[model samples]
Target: MKIIAMSDSHGDRETVKTVSNLSGNAFFHCGDSELSFDDPLLEKFHTVRGNCDSDHRFPSNVLVEIGDKKVLAVHGHEHDVKRSMMMLYYTAKEQGANIVLFGHSHLYGAEVEDGILFLNPGSTRLPRGGNEATFAVIEWDKTLRISFQNLNGEVIDSLEIKNFTKEH
Candidate 1:
């Protein structure tokens, strides 16, 4: 399955539209979009609510079933991700999610712990930690391939997870 992952756009609708133009079986918006829940531009996304979001229509978290992967998507603020991911990790495990998508620190990162893949696509509007604004794409099957890209569709980083399994 192919998936597009992005977060923290903070109301930059055009950038989200541009990035969503890419091909994918699923699209995920990890929140802080500052867009309405039913915004036309975000129509294709499985979105969660961010701390900055005022839309009551947006859920705090969302569960998406992509291929054989159970993905849990969150904004990270309510879970205090900047200080620790322990709570978030527990939530994912409890949800039976094999993949967790989140954004808040505006930092791009990816890591696997005890068979679960956690990804932060960074902030497309205001990147932090000296990184450029970016989003992420994933291609998963027997292996997982991740690509972090800028608004111009330029790849900034790439990673391949050959050991990520469906059964977390």
Candidate 2:
């Protein structure tokens, strides 16, 4: 399965559309989009509510099942992600999820811990910690391959993670 994850657009519809156009089987918006839930572009994404989002129609989190993997998607603020990922980690564990997808700090990063994949796609409009606006593509088969790409579809970083899947 191929999954595209992004967040913190802050109203950049064009960037969101661009990222959505990428080749992937699934798409996620980690929030802070500041766009309406009814927006056509958002319709293609599995979205969560961001701190900046006022759309009550959007849920605060979502659990997506892809193949045998369970992915937990959230905006990260409720879990106090700016401070640490500990809370989010525990939450994912409790949900029996193999992957946790989130964004809020506008910084792109990925890590594997105790068979869980934690990813933050950063901000597509206002990126912190670097200049390049970024998103991530995760290709999962027997292993997980993550490619962090720029808006132009150029890869900036790539990570191949093995043994990161939760045993059934």
Candidate 3:
């Protein structure tokens, strides 16, 4: 599966549309989308609510089963994202997911832990540190492969997930 991940849009729906349309794949907005779930363009999108989203209609976290992969999606604000990954790691595991997609730090990251893949697409509208606006893609074929791309569509990072099995 090819999936595009992004977060912290803060309300810039155009960038989301641009990337979402080009990929022709499912889009996952980690959080801080700052838009109503009723968004017209997001009719087919999957997302979770962020700290900024106070609407009870949106959830702060979600678990989605895509093919053979179980994915945990969250915004990370409630998880104290910058301080540690311990909570996030365990949360995903508890969900029995093979992949975790989260944002809120507005940074890009990809790593494998105990057979699980963790990914953050960074912020497309308000990036932190020296990072540029970015998003992520996951391509899987019995294995999860991740690649991060900037707004210009240049790949900045890549990783492959391993140790994934029913035992995990």
lDDT winner among the candidates? Answer: 1
| Tens-place lDDT digits, model 3, residues 1-168 | 677888888889887787777663567888888888888766666889998876557788888877677888899988888899999988987889887899999989988878788889999999988988889988887566788888788888887765455554
Clash totals for all candidate models: 0, 0, 0
In terms of TM-score, the best-performing candidate is 1
Candidate 3: deviation at residue 96, Å? 0.2
Model 1, position 127, has a per-residue lDDT of 98
In order, candidate lDDTs are 0.92, 0.91, 0.82
For model 1, residues 93-151, the per-residue Cα lDDT tens digits are 89999989999999999988878889999999999989999999988878899999999
Q: Sort the predicted structures by TM-score, highest score first.
A: 1, 2, 3
**C-alpha root-mean-square deviation, each candidate:** 0.9, 1.2, 1.8
List the lowest-lDDT window of 10 residues for candidate 3.
159-168
Candidate 2 local lDDT, 37-145, one digit each (tens): 9999988899999999988899999999977889899999999999999999999999998888999999999988887899998889999985599999999877789
Query: Model 1, residue 71: displacement in angstroms?
Result: 0.5
Cα deviation of 95, candidate 2, in Å: 0.5
TM-score per candidate, chains pooled = 0.97, 0.96, 0.91
